[model samples]
Target: MKTIWITGASSGLGAEISKQAQSKGYRIVKLARSFSTSKMENQNIISVHMDLLDENQVMKTVKYLSEQGLAPDVVINNAGIGIFKTAWDINQQEAEQIFRVNVLGMMALTGAVIPIMKEKQSGHIIQIGSQAGKLATAKASVYAASKHAVIGYSNAIRLELKPFGIAVSTVNPGPIATPFLKQADPSGSYENSIKKWLLDPTKVAERVVRLIETPKREVNLPWWMNVAAKAHAVAPHLFESIAGPFLTKK
Candidate 1:
C-alpha cells in the first residue's frame, strides 16, 4: 500500500484528507503538533509529533519514518497559519510567524523528504496553496505573499524533480468553511460576507486525495474563482477596478 504523509492532520482539510485517503486503502502518517500529546498508531495509520516551526523536530520525524520503513510515497504540505489584517495593521511577529509556518516550515519538510524521494526516484509532493496567492486582495498582504512563495517554490521544484520521476502538485482553493477561517478572521466579517461561496472542506479534501492517482501541476477549487484569478492575472488593474469592492470584503 502507498504511504501518505499529511501535515496538520489534527483538524480541518488535513484531517478530512487523511480520512478519505485511508478509506481508499492507503497507509497514513499524520504529522501535527497536536499529535505530540496523543498516541494514534494503528496498522493503517501512524501519528507523529511535528511542529513545522521547529526544523529540528521535522528532521527527527522524517528520520523516525525512514528508520521505521515508513518513508511516504507522497507528502502533503498542508500545515499553515494565517492572520488576516491590513498591511499596516499586522505586526512584525504576526507577519514573521505566517511566513515561517506557511513557507519556510513547508520548505524545510519538503527539503528533508526530497533526498529520500530522489533515492527512490518516485514520490509526490502536494502543497496546499491559496487563491489569494494568484489574485491578491485587501487585508491579506502577508498571507497572500506567503502563499505566492509556496506556488513559486512549487513551480521551480516541479521542473527540477521531473527528470527524477518525482511529481509536484499544488492545490489552490478560495475561502473554505474550516476552522482556518475562524482563526484567520476572528471578527467573522470575511466569513459572513463570503458565506454563500465558501468551498466545502470535504469536497476540497476529495480533490486533494484524487490528485495522488492523477497528478496535476495545479488544481484550483470552485471553477468560478479560478476563472477570476486567471482574469486578474491577465489584467490586474482592470480586474481590480472592476472588483475592487468585492475584493475588499476580506
Candidate 2:
C-alpha cells in the first residue's frame, strides 16, 4: 500500500484530498494547524496538528512518523497563504509573515521529510505552488515571489534528490475557491471576477493525490492557466499594461 503525508489537511484542498485519498486505499497522514474531529475520523488516516512555521514541531512530527515505521512514500507540502495587496500596501512585517507561512514554513517541513525519504532511497515530494509563481503583478508581488521560490526550490531539488530515489514535483494552481479567499480578497471591484476564475480546492487536491501516486515531474491543473502564465512571461510588459490597473487599487 502507498502512504503519503499531506500537509494543509485542515480544510479546503487539503481536507478534500485526505478523504479522497482514503477512498482510493492510500493510507494518509494529514497535517494542519486547525483540525476538526468531524473531518478526519478514518482508520486509514493519521492526523498530525502542526504549525508549519514552527520548525521544531515539524521536525518532531516527521521523526515520530519515522520511528513508527510509517515514513511516507510521498510528502505533499500544501499548506499556504496569500495576501493580495500592492507590495507596499501590506507593509514589511506583513510581507515577512507571508514569506514565513508560504515559503520558510513549507521549506522547514520539507527539510524534515527529505532526509528520511533519502534514507529509504525512494519517495516523492510534491510542493503545491501557484500560477502566481509563474507571473508577477502589482498586488501579488510578495505572493508571486514566494511561489516563484517554490518553483526554484522544487526544480533544483528534483535532480538533486533524484540520486536518492526521491522525486520533487510542484503543482501550479491558478485560483481555488476556499475559505482562504475570504482572507485574500482585495476588497476591489474585481472580487467577483477573481472568484469566478478559481478552480475547486477538492479538484486541486485530487490532482495532487493522483500526480504523487504516479511518477511525474510536475502537473499544472485546470490547464488553461498555462496560457495566462506564459502570456505574462513572453510579454510581461504588455500583460502588465493590461493587468496593472484592475489589479491595483486606485
Candidate 3:
C-alpha cells in the first residue's frame, strides 16, 4: 500500500480526506495539532501533533519520517487559516499570521519533503488552495493573497519537479461548509450567506483521492466559480461592479 502524509488532518477537508484515503487502503500519517487516532481501527494510521507555525518541529517531524523510511508517496499540504476582513480592516498581525500558516508553512514542509522525494525520483505534492487564489474579492484580501502565493508556488515547482518524475497539483475549491467558515467569520453571517452553495467535504475528498491515483496539474471545483474567475480576469471592473455586493456582505 502506498503511504500518504497529510497536514491539517485534524478536521474539515483534511479529516475527510484522511478517512477516505485509509478506506482506499493507503497507509496514512496524519499531521495536525488536534489529530487523534484512538477511534481508527487501521494499524496503518499514524497521527502526529504538528503546528505549522513552528518551523523547527515541522522540519524535525519530516526529517524523522524520511530517515525512518516512512516517507510518504504523497504529501498533501492542506493546512491553512483565513481571516475575513477588508484590506483596511485587517490588522498587520492578522495578515502576517495568515501568510505564515497558509504560505510560509506550506513551503517549509514542502521543502523538507522535496529532497527525499527527489532522491527517490517519485512522489506527489498536493496543495489545497482556494478559488480566492485565482480571483480577488472584497473581504478576503489577506486570505486571497496567501492562496495566490500558493498557486504561483505550486505552478513553478510543478515545472521544476516534472523532470524528477514528481507530480505537483493544486485544488482550488469554492466555499466548503466546514469549521473554516466559523473560523473565518466568527459572527456566522458569512456562513449563513453561503451555506447553500458550500461543497461537501466528502466530495472534495473523493476528488483528492482521484488526484492521488491519477495526477493532474490543477483542479477547480464547482465549475461555475472557475467561470467567474475568468470573467473577473477579462473584465475586472465590470465583474466587480456586479459581483461586489453579493461577494462582500457587510
* lDDT leader: 1
Per-residue lDDT of model 3, residues 1-250, tens digit only = 7889999999999999999999998989899988542233367888888889999988998977777667979999998999999899999999999999999989999999999889989999999999999987779999999999999999999999999999999999998988998999899998888878899999988999899999998899889999999999999999999998766762
- Order the candidate numbers by lDDT, best to worst: 1, 3, 2
Runs in model 3 lying further than 4 Å from the true structure: 36-41
Model 2, range 170-233, lDDT digits (tens) per residue? 8888777877666776564445666567798778877887886676777776677687677778
What CA RMSD would you report for each candidate?
0.9, 2.6, 1.8
Report the number of clashing residue pairs per model. 0, 0, 0
lDDT, residue 141, model 2: 87
What tens digits encode model 1's per-residue C-alpha lDDT throughout 121-151? 9999999999988888899999999999999
- Candidate lDDT scores, in order, read 0.93, 0.79, 0.90
